[model samples]
Target: MSDNNEYQGRIVVITGASSGFGRGTALELAKRGASVVLAARSPEALTELAQECETAGGRAMAVPTDVSDRNAVAALTDKAVARFGRIDVWINGAGVAAVGRFDQVPLEDHEQVIRTDLLGVTYGSHHAMSHFRARGKGTLINIASALGKIPTPLYASYVASKFGVVGLGDALRQELGEEKITDIRVCTVMPMAHETEFFEHAGNYTGKKAVPIPPTYDPKTTIDELVRLVVEPEDEVITGWQGGPFSFLHRLMPKAIEKLMAGNTNAVQMGESMPAPKTSGIIHQPSKA
Candidate 1:
C-alpha cells in the first residue's frame, strides 16, 4: 500500500525551516499533506515559507525561534501545541558550522556552534520527549552529519556537535527500548555534505570560499530519505551512496581514513577565491538564502 496519504492531517515541527534541508523537507511534507510548524531565527523567511506550504495544499505555521535559547525552544513547543494540539513528528534540523582551522576560529564562534548545533538538539529532544511520553506516541528525527561518525579537520566543533547528536539519539532509543516504549520513536539521519546554504552561512577563517570537501550529494536526496522516515522510522539512517562505505572503511581502517582526511584538509581550506573577511555568519543570527 502507498504511504503517501499517511501524513495527511498529521502535525510536524521542523527547526531550521527557513532554508536548506529543513526548508526543502517542509515543503515536500506539506505537499504530502502534513501540517507543518516552521521554526527558525528568521521570522520573515519562516512566514514566507509558511505561505508556500499552504499553497502546496497543507497547513503551516511560522514561529520565529532561536534554538540556542532553551526558553525560546520551550515556547516553540507551547505554541505548536496551542496551534496544532500535538506534534506527531519533530525534526531537529537547525544547525550552523564554522569552517577553518580550529585554533583560527574565534572562541565565541566555536561556543556558538556548540550551543546551536548540540545544545539546540538537546533542547528539542527534551521537549519532544516530554510531549511524546505524555501522549505515548511521537517521532524525533535528528539531522546529524556523516562527519559525526568520522572526524575531519577544519570542522572540529561541528564534528563534536554532530557526534553529540548521534550519541543522544542512540541513548534515547536505548532507553525507550529498555522501558518498553514501543510506540514512540527516535531516529537520526546522517547524510554526506550536500549543497546547502550552510557553506554560505558558516563562519569562515579559511580566507577561501567554502565548499563540501568531496563527494557532495544532492540536498533532495537527503530530503527524500528524511520524508520517507516519517512513515518508516529507523534507529539511525546513513544516507548517500558513499556514506555507508566511508563509515565502514573508517571503522576497519581508522588510521588510513584519518590520514586521507588529514591530507584533504588543504583542499577544504584552498578555494577558488578568497572569501570575504570573517564574520560570525549565522551562528549568532539568521541569514536568508
Candidate 2:
C-alpha cells in the first residue's frame, strides 16, 4: 500500500480531466487524500470524474474550463484557492496533436497544437506559480510527451510544442531557484502512448489517411506515475521503459537518432495494421481540455 497521507489536506488542480491521463491522475490523487479540482471543457465528463473522486472517499471539485483561454485558466486558479486555502499541485495535462506530413498538414493545426499544448502549459504554470509564490510553496507538474526528447515525423508541431514545454520547465526551475523560492518545485511528466481517445480526437490537418493505435494500456499505469508526481515532485519523470531507451539513444547518438527517426515507424499514423501505441511517440496529453 502506498502512503497517501502527505496530501491529506492539500489541494490539486488538474486540467483536461475529462479523459485519458488527466482523468486517471485525478482519481489517483484524490484517492491519496487530496482535494482535487478537475478542469475540462466537457462539463459532463468533468462532472463524472468528479463524482468518481467523491465516491472514492476523496474531496473534489469539477470546474468547466478551457485551458486555451488564459482568463478561464486564471479563473480556475482563483476558484481553487477560494475553495481550498492553497494550491499544492497544479497539473497541466491538456494537449492536442496532429498526425500528418508537415506539407500535408494545415497551419491551423500547428496553431491549435501551439495554443493547446504550449500555451495551455504556460497559462497553467503562470497562474499556479503566482499562487505558489503567494503561499511560498507548491509543485507545478506539466504533462509532456516522450516526443519532446525524441521527435518523430508526422508530428512536427506536436514535437515543437513539447520541446517548448521541456525548455520552459527547465528555465522556470532555474529562475525559481534564483528568486529563492525553494519550496515551489517544477516537474515534467513524460509518458508514452496510453489507452485513450487522444488519437481519435487529435487534430488531423492532413487529409491524407490517419489511423488509430490499437488499445493496450491498463490505465492504472498512468495513475501510478501521476501519484508519484504528486507525492514526490522531481525535476522530471518519464514512464515506459521502451521510451526511456529512445531518449537515451537520441542523446547518445544524434546522427543515428536522426536517421532512425526518418526511417522509424514510431510516429507513423496508427492504422488497423498497427498493434498499439506502445512503440509510438504519441502520448496522452493530460491537459487537452
In candidate 2 the C-alpha lDDT for residue 181 amounts to 77
Show pairs that collide, candidate 1: none
lDDT of 2 by residue, 62-114 (tens): 99988888999989998998998789999998887877777766676677778
Query: Which parts of model 2 have CA positions greater than 4 angstroms off?
Result: 205-218, 266-289
lDDT of 1 by residue, 1-289 (tens): 2376898998999999999899999999999899999999998999999999999989999999999999999999999999999999999999999988999999999999999999999999999999999999999999999988988888999999999999999999899989999899999999888888888889888878777777888899989988888888889899888989888999999999988887776665674446667767888889955
Q: How accurate is candidate 2 locally (lDDT)?
A: 0.78
**Best-fitting candidate, measured by TM-score?**
1
* lDDT values for all models: 0.91, 0.78
Give me the runs in candidate 1 sitting further than 4 Å from their true place: 271-275
